[model samples]
Target: MASNSEQKIPTMSRQAAEALIAEKMGPDRVPRKFKIITDTSDFFRVDYNDVVILGDNPYWVKRYEKEGRFGLDDEPKYWVRRAIDLSDGSTKILKLVFHEEFETKIGGISIRCFRSPKKEARILDLVAEHPNFMHGHWVLDSAGNNVRILEFIPGPRYDQLIIDYGTDHQDYFFNYFKEVLDQYIELVTAIKFLHDHGEKHGDIRRDHIIHDRECKVNRWIDFDYNYMHGESMFGFDLQGLGNILIFLTGRGDVLVPELYQQQREVFDRLWGEDLNISYKNRVANLQKIFPYIPKSLNRILLHFSIGAKIFYETTDQMLFDLAKARADVIKLSGRTS
Candidate 1:
């Protein structure tokens, strides 16, 4: 971590930013805004998390100013904020999670709550160990408390990205979906590695994954849901993959038959019979979307699509199998080359 002296973040007053937005975008266009959910006048000169700013409403600018910037002591137990990262000089920011101090008794011993401190320490240590987490994160200094920050992965959610691209570049859907498949492969490999270390990433959501320029190589975010292997698989890894596989493949509105088969079996066993029914129904619609995908590639994608759920049960097994498959494919291609 860089010293705070080496990293200086420019803080702008809410009034100044609002004025600039209003001036440049035109008075007719309502500037992006947020709502203030809590009182924060006691601590700081300013506090962003005290208010939830909605891009549609700018009315809270005045409210935030009136509330003033409350310091760290004023933050709630569950407050999270997206702020500028002081580690690097880059404009990239990170999301910080903060919690209030707690006290309790455990094993007949009095234990002061160190939830915030412990969580930050864990994330910082994780980032240090994982190459994928090398950038865009840090822990913040709180007033006699612990604060944790995660790299603010920039980009729309995968579903939103697909929707945006589909609307603007409908012709590129085929190639884009293929690229997303490659991304899934990379993500699974990383997750497999983590699971190998007995770590479980509890929260795996599209929105949590970022698509920054650097992310194409290695992508994802949100370490809070991460836990140990003994916890839970969260409805099988592949089912989660299948759910997004449909969306990533431009079947966002449905599920493809090949991919649907794998999803039905795993999710049905994990979530319930209802999910399997949903998968089948969705796959029915997907068959129509990719009528033109080459039969061979379609088979391959379909295999992985469902296989994600079944094979992900053991990270080691999945990694070994995937590596072997890649090697076999490489040898065959080598002979041709």
Candidate 2:
């Protein structure tokens, strides 16, 4: 009774199989010999000294530090450090997840600082075949820590592109916008691939999407919060995609607190008085606020964002529409040029 698709399930490699097993068994089951990478620079050092090697021994950790400080904490704990691969003598980017007993309460439950590098590694392995996903070179596992060696995708972050070219240059912005639309279609294709395999990217923020100018491809990164095969979180990824489109259209300024407050009265009246409006209604409000969105694309966006409409039941459906929109833009651009 096996369908052709089910019968064609590819055999997982030994390493990938081991990673899945290790993930299911948790961090405690990871091997002790496998070294875990950690940040040990003067500014911010990981507290745990017994388990892993400090990555910031002699190398410059300046560029590796992210922009914002972690919470009220002054220094950055998590870091992306360069490590020399002993097997090949080449350098690789090691993503270190180091939290120093930071605790916070969420939804009436106390949560402690914890890293899920194994889970991330497994998810990376699952999506490795996808062109848009960043490859996981190797996973180093220790009793208390896990280190993932990810492919160092060289490119400017999507947000950086928005900052550099989103405004002040009308022609360039339109060209870049077209490019972003193409990239968004490609992203939808990547997400379709994930959904086909029964996985969902739980987090799909703008920063996580990188446009590699060298490869001319959009790479999706950070599987830290990815959800494995599940039915409960079905439409959340669609919502994330909608947000990304809104950002790409340069209307992200509308998401600011002041702007949101300005539109709150109209939003409530239009979408009814529900304080916690649905994702679809939220997107509909976005459509209402930004009436300048092109008709061809706005239809697609509204279909995905509006609660009552169900035109895009799957990522493939959305992908098809996006591809058409991209092609239409290209044709229009050609004519204008």
Candidate 3:
């Protein structure tokens, strides 16, 4: 790791930072505009004008500040920029590291979580040649902090596509449904390959999967989340996967707002227990609401329901059911409704 004790991070005054962060986490207060710090040094020249500031997700910035890790700069040191690699003139993602901490519950399991850039760097090396993962190189910046130089994949994020086409549920269902399911299988299979190699994606949001338009494949990004799952090592990720399945299969959630558009009979007939256990508020009962969704696939979703007695422990196990659902649903989807 290179050292640049001389390279100072921009930060807010302790009192000011405390107040600003309090507003960020507070229930009632609206936050004021704050400066976002940008890093543009080293072997790569960051496009300073285009830098994007992504804050510590689990809210560890406050602690880092309390510990004097972020002493008196205008903002947090962690940020990303599109940079031109001075050596080869190739553009790459320059990701600055900032440690974070938090906790979340998945399937009744308490999982302690934090940033693990080293693990992500190692996985980047592991998937350097793999098509489904973004190619990246890790280096220590002049400040002795880890920096990831990533090959940027160009395309819409998976989540955006879901949200877009899913507006017309029937059209999305008939035209894109099978293809989405197939792509999801490929994604999970890629994840299973990582698990087989004794690694975890750690974070698995729908947005993390980017559809590489030129290559026509979904590429996974941002694997920095490292968590402590008690019994099932990949429990948190599995929950995320299940959530994605719910979103994809249902062709978007039919929540309270959408319910107003439906017949009063339709709205009144549904019950809370019929909704997904993990995401109760925003979505509805797919099996009941959309009876066209095959039971084969609907049964698989039940594991994430309130009445579930078992949860998927592994990607391979989830894939087994997915394969079965794929076969049944594809066959059922062929018929006239």
Candidate 4:
């Protein structure tokens, strides 16, 4: 969730904002009439010229043209433009054509993933009112390319909060972690909702989760990816969720080498077989970093760790483990969650 420093962003009056919005948005043209394609199976078969425009347009905000700080947005970022809806003065994003794909493997499961703008557009419609998703609609641009008009959700990202938590680590763990786990349950459940509907959140990342403080949701964003898989179809999405769990339960990650520089004896003691899994050169096992970490939860983290045996088959399995761990930890803490 977002910290209390949200007021750092400035605001302006309605009249002035409207004037600026109109000034930025030049002359309006009649939007081309076309059938908005919601069906993903026939997405590629649609004619380009006939499907030129599918939704309303907004005026571009030129200032964010150069770059956007504090986002997971990868570049050649000119494809992503900010805009203001003249009708309501609400901020929106105009995403243009930027398709890319790759082949990757996680837990011996092969994943063939590609950017699916049409799929994303369809998902926007699906989760239009769902609090956990960033709301948007798809439009066909003048060039007949799939363009997205996304509502701008402003706040520091959940990953940012992970780095910026100001209190004692132990305090965050014993006191606040139960709530985060609850939130994670909500997130995992939301993902399951998508799966049950024959859809997937292809691009799930720690940075993609926005903490909309007012609505009090860790909203997921950027779902342009689609994939084909065999048995573990949701492997990529599950991996992303596992990454989030690791970050949350571990209270960020520990750099054992850094700790070694400070305390050689402690590092030496933590160097043996039961030491936490070192992920990306950092120790991911909260149990090793803070031995107070409960075994039930640490076991889940071990699956995401190096050389772990078990893997979660479904989101339901993950939820079950998370619930069990939360119960064990809450009981150990002697606190009601």
Candidate 5:
């Protein structure tokens, strides 16, 4: 039940993309070698029709070297290298992610650095179907391993977009933000659709929300955090949307009164009674940061924030309404100006 927006994007079938990458990589590359470095159960299926051998002595391979002491948690078990064919000189990276399953409250869920083959296939299927997010990544079947060949998306992250351009970038930023807003709406719509399809995205965060300003589009990148709709941690997805709103407003680190007051209410509801921070001081600060923010909008935000004190059972719907309200105000002001 993916939305029309979700279905509009053109994505290659997992099998078709696999076939193309396999043909390009050629045969007799890995000598039919299959490696399993994970200490977990191997519940993987192999596709002979989509088999591709990774070339020997790949030149463009680079491991991410960090300046930290190596420990059990800091080990790198994957091999990532780029390949460039000489004939037409086409290039792609061969990404291999290895992982193991562990028992958790969420059941025997995978703790992969990347997703498992089935999860990878699901991503491919999503990308093939949704092209607006600018789908360029592909997954190749290598015997039993899942090899990801992705088209590089290079740009500043959406969070950085505001900082880099600020008010001067408002017009450009508005266009970009609108496009991202559509994608974000679509993403949530898709998540709701997934919930309808008996699936859910357990982790939806600003970090996972990717935007390419140059392309004027946004994409939700990692499906590794996806899960079933009724999964224990399902509520995190909605919380993640609130986090996205905080980022979109570009009020990062500003600590507006409305937001603080709203958060205070939630804690009070959970623990009962308000905290020490005076509403007078909080309101004082909002006056300083957003002196130009319309009083009507400020009042709405404050009222909505207070509603959070009551346990925020309807915060998601409230947020969506607030966003539409803000957008409408902006539009009305633009017309008057």
Candidate 6:
């Protein structure tokens, strides 16, 4: 027999919890744009136990310090947690940007730079039609803080997929490589859609690209660093894509240490010498290091990496070349089959 205190207690499942929250937070009160959380306090409750306070709270600061969580400094800026709507039982990811005051040489100033969440919301709105981007659900405000809720995407990071499938499996490398290349092409297509609409995803990295294997969908997230329309923004993103391709090809530092080390030395010597000269030298070094890359694909990668031949002046050009490369691979596969 178990003691009364040791008896198991039933807990609500996530669905039941969300349903209860939704009932509390009336659907009528939910706004299309961001509103302060305090404004809707009558319908929602904050669970303090599971919250991540990003502001300058001494208690939280000390707690995070004891836990050895990185990025907690003397001055912090945001708080993040999950909240439930009492009326409808819907759960939302909440972010709170704090208000601050500073003293400068001239005088005292109050700064409310809580616009990042709003900016992200706006970007999401712009690219809402595209399935590859995350959707912004709502924005709320309370007191002097701003809150943003985004649709949560569930998947593994692009790099994680490479790690799980790329190592200790030379026989499957080609298949995996083709799959990655196909995904990369789709990413390029999505980025092109953004460019066509006059927007730029400033950050493009392996971690930012999430792929749902079951659904066969790729979502690009973390638009906190996104940029507005600019003539050169497309080129900047293209360069990032080139770097991502290099990473996915298993030629990065972790996968091929000796080759990366050699490339690093060359890159170090040419650092800041001249942008064009350095890019050209690095691409040339990569060609020598990763000779397994198909010649056609190598040329396409070089166009983006070096920008000397101007083979990919636009996203369309790159996509066309990629299609051709895929077709060539298919033909070769058929011959072997």
RMSD of each: 11.7, 11.6, 11.5, 10.0, 10.9, 12.6
Please, what are the lDDT tens digits per residue for candidate 6 over residues 1-337?
0011112222334344333333555445333332222332322233242222111100001011011112353332234445443333444445444332332110122211222555555577777777787655443333323345555456766666776665543423455666667778889899888778766676666667877665668888765554332345466567667667656654342223332465575344332211222233233324444445566776665554433456344678788888886666555434332
Model 4 regions more than 4 Å off: 1-56, 63-76, 103-112, 228-230, 269-278
* lDDT for 126 (candidate 4): 91
Clashes of 4: 0
TM-score of 2: 0.61
Query: Clashing pairs in model 3?
Result: 10-73, 10-74, 11-72, 11-73, 11-74, 12-73
lDDT of 4 by residue, 136-166 (tens): 7766543456667788887868777765553
Q: Residue 204 CA error for candidate 6 (Å)?
A: 1.3
Best-performing candidate as measured by TM-score: 4
Error of 1 at 259 (Å): 17
Runs of candidate 5 exceeding 4 Å displacement? 1-94, 100-117, 132-143, 167-197, 227-233, 255-323, 332-337
Residue 238 displacement in candidate 4 (angstroms):
1.2
Candidate 2: tens digits of C-alpha lDDT, residues 127-150: 777779877643332222345666
TM-score of each: 0.49, 0.61, 0.73, 0.76, 0.52, 0.61
TM-score, prediction 3: 0.73
TM-score: the better of candidates 1 and 2:
2
Among all windows of 10 consecutive residues in model 3, the one with the lowest summed lDDT is: 58-67
Q: In model 2, what are the clashing residue pairs, if there are any?
A: none
| Poorly placed runs, candidate 1 (over 4 Å) | 1-46, 49-78, 85-124, 129-144, 151-154, 164-174, 214-218, 226-238, 255-311, 315-337
TM-score comparison, 1 vs 5, better candidate: 5
Tens digits of per-residue lDDT for model 3, 67-164: 11113533433355554332333456666675778876654556788887788788998887788888777765434567666777888777678767
Candidate 6 local distance difference test against the native: 0.49
Candidate 2 scores a C-alpha RMSD against the true structure in Å of 11.6
Q: How far is candidate 4 from the true structure (C-alpha RMSD, Å)?
A: 10.0
